[model samples]
Target: MPAAALKPKPLPTQSTAKRPVQLDLPYAPVAKRPLPAGRPREWYVTHNRRLKAMRLAIALLDSGVYVPNQARNETIRSTARRIGVHPPSDTTCHMVRALMRYTR
Candidate 1:
């Protein structure tokens, strides 16, 4: 066979189908409680404390003031004490470990 005859024919191009149009709906007011009122005062206090501990841990890690190691529990507890967060929770300690890992 001739070289030209050996060439394969190209496949036909696919036609695109029209997509359905989406309609925008007007915003509706949701029956939700106000932010502060939604949560108890103690809840907010605990959340703030956790946030403070996490921020302090990250700052200490960045400043080379606290080094996170395999003994993370001790590191977290000591860091919390140094930063004046007494009796850091397990959640706060875990957050410290996460932050340390993230920075690395």
Candidate 2:
């Protein structure tokens, strides 16, 4: 095969980055989310409460104690405990449970 038919020519090699880079999720530009017009990169921090909150939500639904979208506060709190989520307080658990109910 002629050179033209050989493997496509490679692009000129550029300097390799010296440092390994890490990427963030749920962010738009640098991490694929919309970034500021001009400034340093911004990383969105993930909260652990949301994790347990979501876990509580899913577990309750999975256990059939709470429907995908029709659970009440008591149902969520019970499910949260069963799933090992530490509810900060009765009130907060109440709130997250109610919120989880509506979000379903």
Candidate 3:
């Protein structure tokens, strides 16, 4: 039994592998929760800013804006407008870019 004679034939590759079907499911409606009580004012502000930044980052990603440099302040503000969110302040825009950068 020579080692070279024991080589196995290569397996065939599928052009399209099986993928899970995408379902167009609707989400159940849920009430928005109020912020917890007793938090400092600055804490609330920072929390809200972070939430806005996350939302902006998600919108940017869905619109094919992957790079931080591609998501300039104007672009972010424009996206905010499209998404019905108020135009983000310069600081919020910077935070959005930072989120995209670190997530990458």
Candidate 4:
């Protein structure tokens, strides 16, 4: 290919158009589905722990704590509290950091 053909074109400028804000369905109540019956006790524990870790990780990210280092155990616990969740255990906090690390 020719040198000019190989040259990248300049990118277009971003639009400043305002978009409609999406609102949560607070008034539309959704029923919570219970966990499946007959699962092993260990399975339930692991499942709940994973859910807690995911919630903490999402809350941390939303609050501008992207890096795992910034999400210490105390910070994770505080986020959980703010989000109306029980304070995460040490293992859950570690899992939250791991989620953040791998996702990033």
Give the range where candidate 4 is weakest over 10 consecutive residues by summed lDDT: 11-20
Best by lDDT: 3
lDDT of 2 by residue, 53-93 (tens): 66676676567655434556666666667777664455545
Q: How far is 2's C-alpha from truth in model 2 (Å)?
A: 58
Stretches of candidate 4 off by over 4 Å are 1-31
| TM value for model 4 | 0.71
**After best superposition, candidate 2 residue 70: deviation in angstroms?**
3.4
| Sort by TM-score, top down from the best | 3, 4, 1, 2
- TM-score of candidate 1 to 2 decimals: 0.45
How many residue pairs clash in model 3?
A: 0
- Candidate 1: pairs in clash: none
The lDDT of model 1 is 0.66
Model 3's TM-score against the true structure: 0.74
Which residue runs of candidate 1 sit more than 4 Å off their true CA positions?
1-35, 40-46, 62-71
What is the alpha-carbon RMSD of candidate 1 to the true structure?
15.0
- TM-score: which is higher, 3 or 4? 3
Q: Residue 96 in candidate 3 has what lDDT? A: 99
Off by over 4 Å in 2: 1-46, 65-69, 88-104
Better of 3 and 4 by lDDT: 3
Better of 1 and 3 by TM-score: 3
| lDDT-superior candidate, 1 or 4 | 4
Please provide, for model 4 over 1-104, each residue's C-alpha lDDT reduced to its tens digit, 9 standing for 90 to 100.
Answer: 79999989764434532554455665864798999999999999999999889988988999999999999999998889899999888989999999999997
**Residue 67 displacement in candidate 4 (angstroms):** 0.6
